[model samples]
Target: MSLTRLLPILGWARRYDRDDLRPDLAAGLTIGAMLVPQGMAYALLAGLPPEVGLYASIVPVLVYALFGTSRQLAVGPVAIVSLLTASALSPLFEQGSAGYISAAALLALMVGAVHLVLGFGRLGFVVNFLSHSVLVGFTAAAAIIIGFSQVKHLFGITTERKDHFYETVEEVVRQIDGTNGTTLVLGVASIALLVLMKKFVPRVPGALVLVIASILAVELFDLTDRGVKTVGEIPSSLPAFGLPDFDTGTMGSLIGTAFVITLVGFMESIAVAKVYARRHRYDVDANQELIGLGASNVASGLFGGYPVTGGFSRTAVNDTAGARTPLASIVTAILILLTVLFLTPLFSSLPNAALGAIIIVAVINLIDIGEMRHIAHVKRSDLIGLSVAFVATLVLGIELGILVAVVASMLVVFARMSKPHSAVLGQIPGTTSYRNVERFPEASVTDGVRVVRIDAALSFVNAQHVKKLLLGEADAISGGDVTALVVDCSGINDIDATGVEALSEILVELDERQVDIHLCDVKGPVRDVLRRSGLWDRLDGRIHATAAMAVDAVTHPGTLPESLRSLGIDERHDERPADTVDTEVSHA
Candidate 1:
């Protein structure tokens, strides 16, 4: 592999246009403004000090810009990953405590290591096992959890953390009477301002506006004296480079969480990357994306921050603000670095409620009711997977919930594959085309011949099932009159050893009933498998190019179809040798 391929910046940096600087700078500054508030808010959500979010925005953003494929993807502390970090570390140590902070950094390192391993191994396709339905469900549930988790800050009332969503709801309800009126007003006003700005002035960074306004309001009105909580005394220094503590016991405890974060975070990053890549008509190598994200997370861990990923909202903003290259992200990192250096003290009076409000608004759209309805209408089985994921995540906590959803999705896939769609086909009127007889009632079927098609790869899991279905289709025809079974191999793109064995058994059973078996439309790969297994020689002179040719031969013996005549077949049985026949059939 070339060095440029591994280090993507090497390829793009050399091609950097002078004209791209303006847009890249504009987009970078816009996202930087947005990330200032979002990064800190997400950090607080992850049970860390707000500045850690700013720290994450700096190093991780710079790293991903250098290594990532997407030009517009803005990598930082995202809402879902933050919630996941909190879910993982909250159980082991108190929120914001040094132990919890150290563990969070360790989790980022572990997640980065996993991504690098998967990327280098070219195993990025493993994320596809997480079906879209499962993601929708899991995301929606996690959004709810994240939104509700911020309620204490919104209301300025402390509540004990609970394991389940309902328990959290119960605690919030019991403490409803203790709500701080001043904080509630500020949070509500911040949410309103954000919503209005998003609706009317979308180009403006509403989160930044809210942060500035809230801080100014608190500083001027002395809101802390009114029992309003504030993000007091942010450190005015850049993040120092340091490795997370390497405790084996802590690593063991965090391994599961780290793995989950790696999968979930990479999935989120790649999904958005692919979207923007398609929009701009470029390719995104999935394995390379893993490398980029892995490196970013590693940087985040080494620089006093938590795990980060490409966020949809921030990426959308980046693209809209005219980000033409990863240079925009680098600009974003520079802005965050400047803020950590000089502007940290200015945010000392920023109310916690405003940050909570920003978080709630950010996650509001994640609970997608419309997507649920769409899933229900498109595929009820997928809806079941979605519902299972949503409920499980809400009930069983984030880790177990996603685990159950993945298992359920895999089971659904296996069940469908085991009983794949098989149909008895008949010829359409005045045409050579064959279709399912059940769907095309007007189609004509030849007597003493059954044409069956199985629409799945024939493997050990479904080999027996295909055999049983083909046999059942033959038996469905009146009496023992079936003399020929034409198996359509067009849909059967692949067949394993077990499938060949199953076919052999079927051939023996049919021969006993005095029925001849014919294979039609055999794909090249399946034919090769048959040849290697010696099944091709066993079934010599029985394979044809099309279903119609096979039907004609069975119904009118000692006569060859005009199409077959060109292929050098005899008028009697097709006596062509196996090797030669495949060559002719492939061309036909």
Candidate 2:
């Protein structure tokens, strides 16, 4: 491989021209405008102060831009991952407290370490289990939880605890007398303005506008006396390098949370990176993405921020704005740095209700009801999976939601394998190849010859199903007496030790029943597997080169079964079919 291929920025930067500068500049600025408010809102969602979000955006973007593969993917804090970060750390430390912030920093370090390890091992294919449908369901479920979880903050209620969403909701309703009208009005106004901006003037950076307008409303109208809570003061200047305490007990507690963060955050990053790559007609190396993302996370942890990843929404805006290369992300980082230095004071007066509104509006894109409808229509079991994940996230938690989603995905996969495709075979009227007997009316058995097509690869998982189907077909045709069985081996991709054992058992049973087995058209790779395992050594029947060869073999005495010869089954037909039974294993 070329050195430039490994370092994509080298190739892209080599061709960088003044001609591409305009679009990249515009895209970077537009995305930067959007990122400012988004960064702050995501920080709040992650249960940190707004500045941590800005801290996450600055160095991570520059690091990923230099080392990452994608051209337009924007690296930052994302919605579901941010919520997951909050959930994972909440049990370990109090939200917005010093210990909580330290734990959050530690989590970022752990996430970075996991990514670097995976990238070094080139084990990026692990994210393949995060199916697109699962992501759709997970995002929609997260969106609902995020929107509802902020309800207490939006409505402005005082309570002893803000733990269970259902309980908090009950408290909010029961304590209606304690409701703060000013905060409610502020939330309602922000939501309405953000919604209107999203629907009508979406390119205007509605979050920024809402932030400014909400602060003005609070300050000009003196809403504090009416019970509107502000974020109060924020620290100015850049974050200094520091480390979270790494006590042995803390490490033990963090192991599970870190694992979840690694999986969930990495999967999110891969999915978004792949999308951006596809939209831009580029390719992605998931392993390289891990390195780039890992570097970003390490930067985040060192700079006093939480875990960050390739954000889908921000990347979309970046792509749509015509970002040609990762240069746009670099520019975005500079913008964030400028904001941290000069813009911190402006957000001090910004009401928390507006930030909550900004988060709610941004996550609305993740609520995809249509995907659920399509799943229900095309695959009802997947619909059940989606619903289960949705309910689990809302009533239970994100970790439970993913646990249920993975279980559902596994069940669906196993269910399909349990009923591996099988079909009866018969020759077409005018061609030599066999076809599905059920689909083609012309296909039918000639004399006592039988052809059985099994779709799945021969493995212990579905070997019994194939065995039962073959024996049942033999019983149907011969009433417990049969002369021969032909397996169209083009469909049998590979066989394992257990499958070979099962096949041996079947061969013995067929031998006792006076039935002979014939194999035809096995793939080269499968043939190699069989030869290496010495399966062909104790063979029970002749392996024919093709279906026609198998049929013709029975005509000759040397190839004919002992039962067929004794029974005086001598005649064979020359007729054939053009297309044979086609079968193959699906991708895992």
Pairs with steric clashes in candidate 2: 431-576, 431-577, 432-576, 432-577, 433-577
- The candidate that wins on TM-score is 1
Tens digits of per-residue lDDT for model 1, 210-249: 9989998998898999999988889988898998889998
For the record, the alpha-carbon RMSD of candidate 1 to the native fold, in angstroms, is 3.4
Residues 488-515, candidate 2: write the lDDT tens digits. Answer: 8878888877777777777787777777
Give TM per candidate: 0.94, 0.90
The TM-score of candidate 2 is 0.90
- Evaluate candidate 2 by giving its C-alpha RMSD to the native, one decimal: 6.7
Please report, in order, the local distance difference test score of every candidate based on alpha carbons. Answer: 0.89, 0.77
Off by over 4 Å in 1: 479-482, 559-588
